[model samples]
Target: MTRDLLSPAHTGCLQDFSSRYTRTCRLDAEQVQSLLYVLGTTLKANLNRSAPPKTKYFSVKCTDNVQYIISPLPQASSYLSPVRLKDNSVLLITMKEASTQENDNKLSVWYYAANKKVLDKAILHLTAVDISLDVDADRDGFVEKNNPNKNAWKWGPRGHGAVVLVNCDSETLYRRKPDYKRERILKSSDVKDMSPMVLRTKGPPKLPEGYKLVLHISQSDGENIRVFITSGERYPLVLNSEVLSKEIPYLGTDEIMFYVEGVSFPDKDFDGLVHINLSLLEPIGEGIPETPIFTDTVVFRVAPWIMTPNTLEPVEVFVCSTKDNYKFLSSMQSLVDRCGYKLNICYEYMNRGDRWMQDELEFGYIDSPHHSFPVVLDSPRNGKLDDFPYDVLLGPDFGYVTRVPSRKDVSSLDSFGNLEVSPPVTVNGKHYPLGRIIIGVAFPTASKGRNMTKMVQNFLWAQTVQEPIALYSDWLEVGHVDEFMSFVPAKDRKGFRLLLASPDAGYKLFKNLQNDGHGDAMLFEEIPDQDSISVNEILDDKQLQAENNYVQSCIDWNRDVLKRELGLDDEDIIDLPILFKLLEYRGQYRAAAYYPDMVNLIVLGRNLGIPKPFGPQVNGVCALEQEMVSLMGNLGLTCTFIDDFASYHKLLGEVHCGSNVRRAPFDFKWWNIEM
Candidate 1:
């Protein structure tokens, strides 16, 4: 009866055989012999081998009284295929149903050699017992369960169950047959004992938000163990692992540690798990090694920060205007109207007698024409001028909301009112007040001996409070943080996201324009001042190349410092394509021409005000302005373009320097919160 059951039947496809053999079929001597002959012939044909088999073949009857036979088909079999273990050992794999006598109907994998002999077998331990393996059991064309759109199947252990091959000499088997290569499996005893353990460090059960959490791994017996960390939550947690080594000269042994830094969670009450995976690799031979994996998880809750940007409210905005800025102001008013007239706009007139106005100098340093004007926060209102407070002076330039004003107080003053100023401190060859942070540009003209003391003093005075200052490249004439980056409230009302000018995107657009033969024409048409000069004369190819390099380096440095200070990731950044022009400024040197100023935008609540693109029109619309508006719309922001090409861009200023925001006062007191 067994021989008759095991006899070869003409199945049209391999799927028929896989579906039919759900139960074990006991084989007789004649059936086993016939299977072995067929397997040897198939192996020889597939391997292109002409030599006769030298090894003996045999069958093994499992404890459940089910006889197992390994054989190869004339064609490639989807149900039965050869797989190489990690140790470079080849095994013929097949799925067999659990015995009727056993209560558990678990998956059982049988391993055999090409010579039709059973080497080893084991029952897989499955945590997810509900997994269905009826389809793609061989994993030839299996699509990932998580990703349905993917066409190619991911190659690995596909099912939910885990298998542990027992009583197999992986090294000797690979040595005998050098052609075989496959993924390796661990022993059943080792697999059962594998469980990752987390070592404790100095910290409470709940960690404060934006604080770093250092974790140490307990010493284990294995020499070649690799650990990996991953967060299962949406909160951004940075992970850094120390190099694992067995040689420590000081301790004379291996020491390993993993550092996990917790950032400000998007939500205040975030509690989640961090998973750690440990893999122990064992070398089988000169080929690949076998690994046994263990997983462990840690629970942590993040405490909210003292104060965040969420408490901010809308307030009055300030802009400087002169007789030359009427057109620009008109355009700005139009934009404000388009934004539903939500913003409270105020104007400060510039002093016409200021000597700096005659030449292209630092217009930012010019005082307001009105003596009693509230230019710097917390300044004296008596019209008699003294040195401005360091914090208040720094606050306006950097646009930092240092302190909130009281409703009763007529003048907007900070907490440190009428306090005597302290002397600046010099650290690492740079002069700065104690706990004061200020960002500035490093000009190439500043000498080591001279040290640009006045510029440094001005920067120190402008800082509203002690904060971590991030310095960016200042190769451009009007180089400022506002030129390249802007912080806007997130649409989710959680925090702020940085909007950056992407040089990579701009370069690609410019290259496309150059290829289309409009590069020279566009430059000449945009810069109408240089009517006699050709595009080649206006733009030096060498300088343009150097400017791009500097821009990229500056962007990289700013990104790194911002990530550290603001706890921001790449996903939190919004990049816009804004290119710069290398134009000859004065008769001696070349400077960056920042015309579009898309990133140098004004934020009025949820709406953003930007400068119109300063260039030729493409199909009745400015190309750069259209791109900027489209990008802003994609980010869920309402964009209004203000034409400032003649009044502001020509003077090497943009919407940011021309205007400032006096944001709404929040209830949070800076003095009450810990820095």
Candidate 2:
């Protein structure tokens, strides 16, 4: 007969119903119960072995009537019955005494002992130590020693060996005396007893209203600690506690007000007298507030008194800001110029919004009001708002707003306008209000010499300003200055320089300077402001395009005269076109580096193709073009001169009269012109 352990659902069944003697098994109440008990125990054992391991702790109950079943049970089951066997270590935290005036005035110490007997012996030695005999012991310094046991004092050696002590002065000591004096301090007592305290006062303990006092106890050392607090005071009462000292509230004045006190238990060294002065509390709070309670958190750490002595010279300039913008506005040069007084700025990065600034204006009453940017003045007396002038040199009528997309072909005239060629003192496309006309100049290429200068003058004259003339140049493209470079020169010229290798309009200007022995005037470099990054490349491209266009315009103008007015013919026009092409494309790429002598060849080889207007004329045209290009290059000027505007205008008129109407401003039909 084999026993099967795995099968729970299968059981022995009656086979061949008519086998009377073979079915000798008992089916009575006691037999059934006994068999079930055995089966249940065996099944439970097997199931327990097969079940996977559980990681958490659990409570289990076993009963004789209850069969082994994996199912939920009620809470009142026998499993929940209490059965204690082993004892565990316990910690006792006790408050020994409240902090009264006597305790508050003294330095306190708490001692730990294993048992009452050890504590008694320690107390006896401590009481007899004669702490005064120690070197440098202050007779006046207050000192108090406390132990856990109340009965241990009786066993302590009296007179000389008493362990517990108390005092009400400064620098009191607790010393351990020599063995010879131990007997003298110790009392010969057969049983335990108690003693008393020295210098008893006549008054009862006094505490402020709403303060529930308690003595804190250290678990490991059994040291007792205590501190008192009023209703609103949240002081640190625990030793070695983490303490955070908060700022006191300001009472609405330049003299800031804040209270000092500890507010935690873990830090023990938080006791110090804070003088509570304005300068010391400068960095304490956030900016001003709308309501008294809406001020910023006034928490800060103050160094020792020596670090901020009372005799320290008061700063002339009172620095303050409601917004966080002034955080990085502390450069020494800016400080001297912007703030009239010495550096006395409160460095608190409080984000209180508009109300902060409003409060500053009310409380600080600074002469100049600073919102997003500082309102700096040339002098302290000039801080009056009226002293500074509005940036309206261009005047009202002359102003125009146009969103000129940054283009390679056009230089942005100003933040709000675009430029077209014009002359000086043209008032709004009408009259010439020739007062002192101030013209502003800005460009990526500073070496443009008199060309840009004259161009700016031309733009101003086209605007027609009726004021005295004041010409300004932005030498530096500072971020803000880049937008208003044409209007104000004082703030923008710091970084201005004539970049020789700028590869823009400056290229032509640089060449001119090199030819004229004034190249040194244009060569300069400086770090550009970060905010001007967008305009940097855009302006550079514009400058390059303008330079190229100027060159082409000059060549086209000269060619027109040489062909039509001077009657030079088609060969002459072709040759001039070649010259312009050579001048523009000669040093374009790696080819120039290889063929360095090509410039000289082109200069000497240039000659007209033929005198005929439409005949075969490649050689003469190519030769003439080379000569003209080389000659132009040697001059170091990109043919920007507008010598005959009137003649050009007349020729355009004749062309327009005979030409067909076209959609584009410049587009026209040659047939129409001929007709």
Please give the CA lDDT of all the candidate structures.
0.35, 0.19
TM-score of 1: 0.39
Candidate 1 lDDT score relative to the true structure: 0.35
Residue ranges of candidate 1 with Cα displaced over 4 Å: 1-312, 340-350, 353-375, 378-438, 441-466, 492-494, 513-542, 581-591
RMSD of each: 24.0, 35.1
Question: What is the alpha-carbon lDDT of model 2 when measured against the actual structure?
Answer: 0.19
* Model 1 worst lDDT window (10 residues): 35-44
**Which tens-of-lDDT digit does each residue in 215-263 have in candidate 1?**
2232321111222232232212122223432111111112222222222
Residue 523 in candidate 2, Cα distance off native in Å:
30
